[model samples]
Target chain A: MIDWALVARTLPEYWVGLRVSLLLLFVSCATAFLVSIPLAMARVSRHAWLSWPVWAFTYVVRGTPLLVQLFMVYFGLAQFEVVRESAAWPMLRSAWFCAWLTFAINSTAYTTEIFAGALKNTPNGELEAARSLGLSATQVYRRILWPGALRRALPQYGNEVVMMMHATAIASTVTLVELTRVARDVYYNYLAPVEAFGVVATFYFALTYAMVGAFKLVEKRYLRHLAPRETGPAAGRPT
Target chain B: MLKKLALAAVALAAFMVQADAQQTRLRVGVEGNYPPFSQISPSGQISGFDIDIANAVCAELKMECQLVQQEFDGMIPALAARRFDIIVASLTITPARLERVDFSAPYYDVPSQFVARNGAFQSHSPDALRGKRIIVLRNSPRAAWLQQNYPQNELHLANRETDVYLELVAGRGDIAFGSSVVSTEQFLKRPEGAGYGRVGEPVRLQGGTGGVGIAVRKGDTETLAKVNQALAAIRSNGVYRQIMARYFDYDISPSN
Candidate 1:
């Protein structure tokens, strides 16, 4: 048995943390999506120099642990004079900004791989047909190539977004007040791991489950065209 | 045939003895992020003030020590679930904690203090908060103090002491509250705390000085007593002072 009052009291703390965690998730996901498209294009290019830079960037970001990357960007970069003098320092000076940057860059590596695979699966015939239509290179990418590739990458991209939602848990390490951070505050009251963590576990379970639900909603919307129009099994549920 | 049977019996006994030796190992849990206290070295080996003391504690108990790395917030939960036997990660002994588990004799005593980059640190009462916000480590005694004293001000709670320092520097809020032991390294660098200042005269002037002790599962009285004896031996043998020097400059001796 546990005290419901204590658990109720802890909910607000977790909510505050949850909000920050979601904020981090949104910021990182948007950045990673923007970065991945260009990096994937470069990776698919014939030019060695341009593609190789993207390769090295992806390799280094992937090779290191997220904790080390957070430390390096937050504490390590603060050491350099050039970064200090640059306009980027305004963003870097913030722990939240630095954490968001780390999450974005880290996800970019994984997302780049996903985008590259999707790009590879882009039909050669469609590409040729797109070319015959006299579509400009950028137009071809915008209209045909990107949409098709993105459809192939949706399932994977969805997973990344969900994982990022949970990965926001680590932001607490660098000083972001996410769900895990609030768990610690609850611990102060109960001092009992079982009592405090019981609430925390529920918060995380709710959060992770909510993320799962949201991802599914996104998946359904993206794949709705594939869904049977007539006599589909129980089409929509009321909120 | 008789000789062969006798030799087999002796071999079985030797194997049993070897198995018995391995079960006597002591498992230690640590966060491994709080450097100079508990951290993972570049070589992947766990080493720090707590590690050294844990080793000494194990030696005194006549058991081999095994170090396990866990997040600070999850350490106690893991222990409750029997993931490990003891926590030596500068865990402050508190009443709220005692309800769920038990603690050994105090090993290190350090006062909980606050630092502010803003002009002189201010507080109307233990409960009062004007315009200034105090950042505190999540899941620590400072959070306990805030929750008990100023429940409304939690909206301004900073997750970690480091975050508090950064927030103070960024002018997000005003003060950062933590223990002397945790802030000693930063304050000593400033000498007069020239850049930063301490808040209030210091509360919990007696038992509230932030004494850290090892936490063990409830009902593990034997282990608790053994740990207390080991801690006392470390103090008497001067090993405590040596371990204290690695992470702290001040003499934060626990009153026996």
Candidate 2:
């Protein structure tokens, strides 16, 4: 049922689309990672004043559909004359920039919640022990809280990154020409959904597996102390 | 379990046959977003030039017409899948589309034109638009034409024709190119579009046939012929002109 010949002939176009999808995935992932760190910290703050706005940001972003949010950024913002005449119009007008901003803000909300939850779950004994060792509040956070919480958040964050990769498909609606958009164009031109979407499915599957594999390696490195103690020498062998 | 599966398959085949036997109703597909061609009213009725033309064609063919709203991109696929008998979606007759479905004779034609802020350009020439951002509907003939002829211009593709105009108005694109009917009726007539005007003359691209027609499944010659006859009847009996006058003052029929 697979059209291997067509897949071969159209590989280059798919490759270009793959590059776009990956660019969106990596850039948005990096932006989310950086933004979520501070947002998560603020979310777990002792003061409500520090945390409420972040709460509201995550609440609204997580509550709405990503497509709606994308549209709001892409089309809704342009409805304002002030936005059209703003200094940022040059960047805001580019579909790629709008898509990146939407995805970054979206993933940051979800990732911030994940990191905050993990931070809250950090062992209280560790914080007490750090404090007892004469470590300042900033030193405790820098040396103990952030690292431990991050390690705990790794698996969930990995899943979030993969979800973000899939979510990038929606960027096509804004005409960014990512993987899903390329598949759609191919389907439109060739009238062969089987071959077109099949290729897309394969690419996504491989990328997801690669992401999962990388996360497994990172988890092994960072969460090793959390693993069950091995009794035999051979038990140390990599799975 | 095996017997039940076989029974289910047989039942599906019977239903398919029943569906095929019911030919009294002409199921028409329309994209309700394309203004002046087809649009959904606030009350949810599909009405526009394409819808009216489809209604006239159905009257001539003596079939009850049912309008099904579909996205423009999915209209042909929906027809091939038998979701509808014909598409009256202002779909341009193009060689790429002909490979998948058959189209009746042209019912109307509207040249593609570029719209930009007033005084953005004196002419729509490659030199004038060089290095300027241009927006067009994705997968459209205008997009293909821009990519081929004005490769120097920065091209942006928008999924919706409305978004192309939005990009232009927002200063993302220097010009927006799309159907003249849509540009004039949907955008140019709107208050927000007051600052914009059609730039240069309507662009007639080579191999970009602007003819809009009723689309049917490939090899469906009987329905194709009936649609063509109905189209010709409407045009000759002045029904076409009457309908055209309601929506547009100028002639939109194919130039040839």
Candidate 3:
């Protein structure tokens, strides 16, 4: 059974946690989106000099667990005396900064791969048509290649967003006071896992639902051409 | 299908009966990361002051001691969930924990202290630490004390007790507040803690009974009594002192 009364009393704490989780989610998502574009571009580059390095970067980051990466950034860097004495120590010392950096990098790796796959899957005919229009390489990328790939990448990108949101829970281990951390603190105080984790699960479920629904709308608008032909009277009606 | 289910239930009952018959086995939960108190050595052996004490108590009870390594934060919940029978994890006796689990009579009462880079801080007063980062284990009584007493100071709550010192040594935090036993034995004695030293006097929070005790599930008075009896036997028979001598130069036995 759920403890509704405890849930009512802990609304303020959950609110604080929700704000932290949202901030972490939004900031890292934006960072990932921006950074991934360029990295994804390089990942799909024709030149091995550019694509191989990006490929290696994503390979190393994606191969390892995000939690381990987070710990390395948050705790591992501090183990070195040089890091402690450096100017960057001020930023590295912050839990928020470490968490954000880890999440952003992790998301960047996955998002880059998603976008790269989408870019690779771009129709050869589309590229030919863009070149035939006398568009330069940059113009082709901006006008045709990037837009089509991004539209194709929408559904998978939506999945990455949801996964990143869930991954933010690990930020609590570094003491970011996100939703999971708040739930853990509540559990520590009340010893009621049902009341603590159950409420957090609801919050996460609601957030995920909203994200999924929003992604659906975006996909519908951008991916309309890929959808099956409408079977309306004006469409395939016999003369 | 119904007949098979009934037969399976009968088999489970027999298994439970056999498990209950094993009275000699004692499953003890321990956080094998808290040095001096408990830690797993490089050889993967779990040994410490707490491990020795638990072993001595098990010896007295003539029970087979099985140490189950667990995280400090999850000790109580694990105990409640029957993951382990008792916690020998240097768990402080506090009212909040008392609400969930019953504790044995205080086995040791080590004072808390603040550790900072030597000569970096003069006093542990709020004014001196104002705006300075003070690291402590999250959800700890010491964190609660700092929140109440030193509101102006920034509190960085690390997940593990060792992290409190790690963050300090990493220059992330200006001061570390935690068990004196751990701060002294685990950190200051190690090479990594070369520049750090205790800066403040022994701090015992007013929130708890100010003693560390073994925790067992609440309402399990039978196990509680046995643990208490074993503790008394160890103390009277000099086992407790022998173990204490191995770890500390001073007496750590519960006062009063």
Candidate 4:
């Protein structure tokens, strides 16, 4: 039932689409990493004025569908006369910039919540120990709190990254020609949903596995001390 | 920040009011990206041949026309969901589509033609374009025709009619197939299209059933009859020809 010849002939096109998908994934994830840190801090802050706005942002963003958010950014914003007349129109008019901004902002909301939840759960004993040792609040956060929270948040954050990769498929609605778009085009031309979607399914499956594998490596390195003592034949062999 | 908040609040209230007031107006669905047919202008207003036709029909029927922007592929589903009363997009009548919804008499008919760079292809025959990269609009009759007749050719399906020409110009494909009016008026007459020209005779489907029509929900005889009457009224009056002249130099009526 597989059309290997069709797959071979169209692999190059799919590869180009894969590159675009990866570009969107990596760029948006990197930007989300940068933005979510401060947002997460504000989310857990003592000041209601500071925390409420960030809370509202995450609540609204996370509550709405990403596709609606994307359309609001890419198409709805352009519907305004003021937006078109503004200097940012040049940048906002580009599909790549719009997709990147939408993905990054959407991922930031979810990541911020993950990081905030981890931050709130930091052990009280750790904070007491740091204060008793005379570490200033800044130093304590920099050295102990941030590191511990980040390490705890890593697994959830990794899932967010994978989810963002899947979310990149929606960029095709604005004409980015990513992996799902390529598969759809091929399906349209060939009228073979089975073969076309099979290829896309395989690509996404492999990508998800690779992401999970990378996260596993990270967990091994960073959370090694948390692992139970190795008791297998090869346990005592490694450094 | 305060001004922006107030503006957003007002916009939200306006949307709520509009949603509540939908019963009295006629909601017409249109794919606003297809130039020369139905396009959203820079001012965010819908324009072009299909928009004008829809407006004229609404006027003839004495109903208020509120055009709703929709993607072509989702037009039928949206209609079934009652998001719109009728689809006035440049939707061609096809047997497969007739299974889902009913179509009024064709408002206009245009031939499908192939476009390529100068001297790229001699003809659109299966033998001539066997190994060529061909681009066609997704879910279009032209795409169906290509797949049925020239399955060996490398086919690239574009989401929009404009993208078909873009793929040809970008060297991703050797030829593109779409509405002759769009390829000629929207692309070939422009400066960027100087190197491209029509490569073959217009393609006619096996059943000779290619014509653009307005679609309504299946078994909605009252709306369908009203739409047909409006279409006939416009054709007899000079409104249809006047709208046609704004977009096309040659005749696009069914006879031509």
Candidate 5:
């Protein structure tokens, strides 16, 4: 029922698709980390004006599907005369830039959720310890709190990272020629559904496995320190 | 328990029988985003000349047609995937595409045209386009044409026909290349289209008049002949002309 020959023939094209996909994953994940740090801080801020808007933004973006958000950005926003005239139109006009921006924003929303929770669970004792040593508010956050929360966030952040790797497939809908799009082209050309889609599934499997593998290296590298302490309630007891 | 299993089998058999009897259910593909030739209404139903022609052809064959929307770039691939049985999309029959699939005799023709911002000068080859930003669909025949001939022109491939026009209007590119069908329907019809204009005379160059045709997977002789018969019926019965007038301001060369 599946066309393995078609899969074999389209391997090179799918490889090209894989590169774009991997690039999108790397760029979006990296940018999401940058964007999420600020958004998570604002979201978990003490002031309602700061936290409330960030919370609402996360809620609405999370509520809507990525497809609809991409459509709104790629198609809906282009309908306005001013957006078409803006200096950013050259970059925004490109499907690659649009796909990159959408994925970055979407992943940032999810990563913010992970980082926000980690920020809350930051060791208050560490902050008091830094304060007892005459560390300023900034110094406590920079030296003591940020590193602890970041290490705590690693495992959950790993999950969000894998989610973004799969989400890159949706980039094809806007015309980015990524993995799934290439397979669909092969599928249509050969009229072999089994072969075309099987190839796509295989690529996706390898890609996601590689991503999780890479994350494993990152996890073991930085997390080697956190591992000996992570056992039970004692880890979260904050002192 | 055996009787219950037997009953379930019979029901499944009956369902399959009904589905086979519904062969008259036609599935036609079109780029509903491309107007006049094919376009989708706000309610999400496909309409315009190509849609009407597909319905009439299906009626002549005594089949109930279902319209499916596909992007211009994906139309051929989608049709080949058997997502639908026939492509009523304004697809041009090209030598490269023909290698992979079968096509019915062309139903209509649209000339390929190059368009640029109002102030730009016209040159036929890439030497003039050299260092100039030119827009075309990636991997389409026209893009290939430019790559081979005017390789010097910087190519900016866009996904949709409107994207070409939008970017050109924004001065993002020096020129945009596409079918006359898209240029006439979207750009020339709009008031603000004054900023953009077609270059050179609309000559039959490069890919020729670009004949539009229906396509299916190769070797489906039964499907191919049946579609031909229905298309022949539409042309003879004047239904094709009726559908044509409903959409186009002028008649395209169907005799080709």
Candidate 6:
């Protein structure tokens, strides 16, 4: 049986936690988007020197669990004497900074791989057309490759965003009061697991759908060219 | 093959029932990270004051004690869900917790204290530490106290008792607030805790008695009575004292 009264009392705390989770999600995703563009380009490079390092970066980050990566950054780095006394200790001491840094870097690894895959799938004809049109290498990437590959990567990138949102729950381990921590605190205080965790589950469910719906609209707009054309009588009809 | 597998399943079920009938198994929940009270040794054995007391109580009650290690924050919920019958993890008896779980007679009482780097500040007053981060274990009596009293100070709630001091040593917090015994024995006496010492007087809030008790699910009077009886038997038979001496030079038996 769910306790409605307990849920009402804790709803405000969950809202505050939601705001924190949202901030962490958006900031990390935005940063990963910017950083991954270059890393992903490097990943698909012809030069082994550039490609291998990017490959190694993605391999190392994507290979390990995100929780372990977070712990190493948040707790492990603090173990070193030089790190504690360093000029950057001010920022490193902050749980917010450490969590955001870890999430963004983790997101970058996965996003880089996704974008790189999309880049590899670029139609050879499109590249040849851009080259024959006398477009420079920079112009080719900016005008043709990036736009088309980003459209291809949109669906997978949306998944990464949602995953990143869920991953923010681990922020509670570093002392950030995100949604999971709020639920846990409620559960701790009331011993009402149903009301505590159930409410958080509902919040996550709603957020996930909202994100999925938004991505659907974006996909509809950007990937319209790829959508199947109207068939039979509808193909010849004028609106 | 199907007939042989069915026979093996029946035999396994019968053996499990027989094993269950052999002894009254009691699952005891503990936070293995709280040093001096409960901690896992380098060899992975759970040993400390709380563990010894739990084992002695089991011996007194003639029950088989099985330790279930869990994080301190989840202890009460796990108890309510029957993940364990009782908790012996140095859980302080406070009014907030009493509403959800019933606690046995006090086994030990210790004061809370603040530990900061030597020469950080002498006072633990809110005015002195305003805007400074103070680290305490999440869901703890100290955290509750700081939230209510030190409204101006920033509170950093660590997931484990050990992490309270770890955060302080890592310069993540300006002060560490926790069990005086743990701060003294587990932190100040250790090499990493060098240059850090108690900076204020002891605090006993909530019920103000600071009794640490073995907890059972609310309305579980049967287990509560058994735990209380076992505690009394161990105290009278010197088992409690023997365990106490191993962890502390000072007396910790609750003063009634």
Highest-scoring model, DockQ = 3
Put down candidate 5 lDDT per residue, B82-159, tens digits, no spaces.
788888877777765687678888888766678886658665465666688888775566777777777777787665
Judged by lDDT, which candidate is best? 6
Mind giving the per-residue lDDT tens digits that candidate 4 earns over A1-239? 67789888888989999999999999999999999998999999999998999999999999999999988987678767688778987788677899999999999999999999999999999999999999997898899889999999989999999999988999988768899998987765554566778999899999999999999999889888789876888775876
Q: How do all the candidates rank in terms of TM-score, highest first? A: 2, 3, 6, 5, 1, 4
Q: What tier of docking accuracy does candidate 5 attain?
A: incorrect
Quality of candidate 2's docking, in CAPRI categories? medium
Which is better, 3 or 5, measured by lDDT? 3
Candidate 1 clashes between residue pairs 3 or more apart in a chain or in different chains: A184-B139
True contacts kept of each: 0.33, 0.60, 0.73, 0.03, 0.10, 0.63
**For residue B96, what is the lDDT in candidate 4?**
61
Tens digits of per-residue lDDT, candidate 5, A1-239, equal: 45566566678998899899989989999998999888998988999999998899889889999888887777667777899888888788777898889988888888898889988997778777888999987787788777877888888898888888888888877768898888766654454556777778877888778878887898898778757655677765768
Q: TM-score of chain B only, all predictions?
A: 0.77, 0.86, 0.81, 0.80, 0.78, 0.77
Worst 10 residues of 5 chain B by lDDT: B201-210
**Between which residue pairs do clashes occur in model 5?**
A2-A194, A3-A195
Where model 1 places Cα greater than 4 Å from the true spot, the runs are A2-5, A81-87, A192-239, B1-91, B101-108, B112-136, B142-178, B182-256
CAPRI category for model 4: incorrect
List, residue by residue over B35-96, the lDDT tens digit for candidate 1. 66777878988887878889999988888888888988677778988788899898878777
What residue pairs clash in candidate 3, if any at all?
none
**Cα lDDT for residue B232, candidate 2:** 90
lDDT of 1: 0.76
Off by over 4 Å in 2: A1-4, A232-239, B1-25
Cα deviation in Å at residue B60, candidate 5?
6.9
Is model 6 an incorrect, acceptable, medium or high docking prediction? acceptable
What is the Cα-based TM-score of model 4?
A: 0.56
